[model samples]
Target: MARAVAWRLAAGLIFGISTAASAAAESFDCVIDPAIVVKVGSQVPGLLDSVIINRGDRVTAGEAIATLSSKVESATVALMTVQAGSTSEIEAQRARLDLAQNKLARVEELVKRNISAKSDLDAAIAEAEVVKRELALAEMRKRAAELELNRAQAVLEQKTIRSPITGVVIQRSLSKGEYLDQDKQLATIAQLDPLFVESFLPVSKFGSIKVGMPAMVKPNEPIAGTYEGTVKVVDSVFDAASSTFGVRVELSNAGQKLPAGHRCRVSFDGTTD
Candidate 1:
C-alpha cells in the first residue's frame, strides 16, 4: 500500500510540471493584417479628369482622391448662379407696379372729384392688379432660380471622388483620362491603423483566452520589437477538423510604424516569442 501511494505522488508531480510548462509556452503563429481593405470608385460614371493620389500615398478621410470631367456641370452651375443673382426682371416688374399704382391713385382722385369717368377708374384698378401679379411672378421665378443653382452645385460635387476612410493607397486601377464607371475600381486602400493580428488556437485553450485580454505580438525578423495588443475577438465556434478556434488581437499602429502582412507570433500570457 505504501509503494502504491509513492507511485501516485510521483505521477502527480510529473503532471503538475507538464502543465506549468505548457502554460508558459502559450505562443501561436499569427499574421498581421490591415483592419480593412476598400475598393474606391466613383459614384457617377464619367471620364476621369485627374487622380490626385497615387499608389503608396497616405490619404485622409474626405480628401479628394479623384475628379471626373465636370466642365459641363461647372458651366451649368455658373449659369444658374448668374440667374440666381440677377434681379433685373424683379426690378422691372416693381417699376411697372409703381407706375400702375400711381395711375390708379390719380384716377381714383379724379373720379371722386367728378372729373374722370368711373370706367377710367376701373381700368386703372385692373392695371394695378395685373402689375402686382406680374411682380409676384417675377419674385417666384427668382426663388426658383436660386433653388436650381443649389441643385447644379450638388450635381457638380458628385463628380469629385473623395476617400471614404483614412488609409494608404495600395493600388491605383484607373488613371487620368480613363473612362470610369460605377462598377470599375479607381483605387484600393488599406487601413493600417489598429492592425489586426489573427491566429488559430487549439480548442484546449479556448476558455483560457478571452476578449479584452492583453497579448504580446512579436513580428518575424526584419521588423524588430514586440508589439502589445489587446484581445478583440475569440471565436465561439471551433473548427471541427482542426479542433482549433480563431482569435483576433488589435494593435494600434500610430504613425504607421508597423507595416501589415507580416508573419508574427502571439502570446496570451503577456510574453514575447
Candidate 2:
C-alpha cells in the first residue's frame, strides 16, 4: 500500500510542473496600426471655392488644398484704403494749417501796433487752435483706416489654404462651391513614413516590456526580410474588462509598402540570455 501511494504522489507532482511550464510559454496574436490619425479642417467660414486633391491623393507639406473667391476680400481692402485718406488730402491739410498760423501772426502784430483791437487778436488765436485740432483728428482717422486696410489684406491672404503636413489624403469631406462653417471638417490625412503598429498584451507581459527593447514584427505573411522595431510604449494601467495592456512599436515605412491596419506578427524577448 505504501509503494502504490508514493507512485501516485510522484505522478501528480510531474503533471503540475508540466502545466506551469506550458502557461509560462503562452503567446497571443495582435493587430497592428499606424498609431495616429490626423483630421484636417477649415479655419474660417466660406464657400468652398476649389479642391486640388481627391481621396487617396498623396501631398507634400505646404501644398495648396483649396482657395476661396478673392473678390470680396479685395473689395474690402479697397474701401479701407479710401477711408485712410490719400497723400493729396494730407498735403491739403498741411497747407490749411500753415495759412491759419500766418493769420494769427498778422493779428498779433497789428494788435501790438494799436492797428487792430485785442478782441480780433484773441479770435485769431482761437481759430488757429481749432485748425490744429482738426488736423490732428484727420491724421488719427487716417491711421485707423490704414490699420483696417492691413487687416483686410491679411484675411485675403488666408483665402489660399495650404496643407501643413506631408501625408496622403484619406478622406475629402467638402468640395467646390459647398458652403462651409468654421467648425466643418475638411478632410482626413495620414502620415505614410515611419509608421507604427499598435497591439495589446496581457498584463502579465507588461512589466517585461520597455521602450527601446528590440522586437520582431511579422504579418501573418510578412515581408521577405524580418522587420525590426523597438518597443515604443507600455501602458501604465491594465484594462479591467480585457485584462490586457496596450503597447506600440515604431517601424519605418520608407517605401510605404507596409500599410496601416494590416495584420502582423509580433515577438518580444521573453527572458534574458
Candidate 3:
C-alpha cells in the first residue's frame, strides 16, 4: 500500500508542474484588430449617381469610390467659369472713362483759348470723375464673380466620394439612384496592412512586457506560420477587476498577403521591461 501511494503522489506532482509550465509558456489570448476603419461618405447632398466599387473591392486613397448626380453643380461651375473670364462690362466702363478724359482735355484747351466758358470745364471734370467711379465699380463686380467661380468649383468636387484610406470595401450602404445627404452613409472600409493584435496580460507580468519588443504572432488559418510582431502599446492603467493590463502589437502585412480580423496568439519569447 505504501509503494502504490508513492507512485500516485509522484504522478500528481508531475501533472501540476506540467500545467504550471504550459500556463507560463503561453502569455495570453490575442485578437487580430484592424488599426484603420473608415466610413466613406459624400460631403454634399445629391442623388446617388453610381457606385464605382463593390464589396471585396480593393481601393486606394483619393480614388473615387462613389459619385452623385451632379449635373446642376457642373452646370453652375461652367456658368461661373465663363462669367469670371468675361471682362466685357469692365471694358465698356473703361471706354467711357477714356472718352470722358478726352472731353475734359478738349474743354481745358477751349477754355485757355477763350473759346469755352469756365462752367464748361467744370462740367467736363465732374463727368470724368463719375465715369472713373463707375469703372471702379465694374472691376469690383468682376472680382466678385471670380470668387463665386472658385466657390462653385469647390462645391462640385464635394459631390464625389473618395476613399480616405487604402482598404477593402466591406459594405456599400448608399447604392445608385438613392438620395444621399449628410445623414446618409456611403460605404465601410477597413485597412488590412499593418494589422494590430490586441491582448491583455496580468499586471504581475507587466514588469516583463515592454513596448518595441519583438514577438511572434501565429494566426489560425489561411495564414499559417509565424509573423513577426512588435509591441506597440502597454496600457498604464490596470483593470482592477481582472488584474490585467492591455497590450497591443503591430504586424506588417505589406501587399496584404495575410487576412485581418482573425484569431491569433502572440508569444513574447523574452519580453522584459
lDDT of each: 0.94, 0.78, 0.87
TM-score of 3: 0.81
Off by over 4 Å in 3: 1-27, 109-115, 269-273
The TM-score of candidate 1 is 0.81
Model 2 clash count equals 3
**Model 2 Cα lDDT, one tens digit per residue, 1-273:** 999999999999999998776655444465656545677776677887898889988877788988877789989988887877566656677788899899999999999999999999989989888888888877877888899989998998788777777778889988999876777877888886777767789887877888888777776655455577778888898899999988887887776777777777677754111
The number of the candidate with the highest lDDT is: 1
Winner by lDDT between candidate 3 and candidate 1: 1
lDDT of 1 by residue, 1-273 (tens): 999999999999999998887878679999999999999998899999999999999999999999999999999999999999999999999999999999999999999999999999999999999999999999999999999999999999999999998989999998999999989999999999989999999999979988999999999999999889999999999999999999999999999889999999999887764
Worst 10 residues of 3 by lDDT: 264-273
> Clashing residue pairs in candidate 3, if any?
none
Tell me the deviation in Å of residue 24 in model 2. 14
Steric collisions counted per model: 0, 3, 0
CA shift of 2, model 3, Å: 30
lDDT of 3 by residue, 78-157 (tens): 99999999999999999999999999999999999999999999999999999999999999988999999999988998
lDDT sort, best first: 1, 3, 2
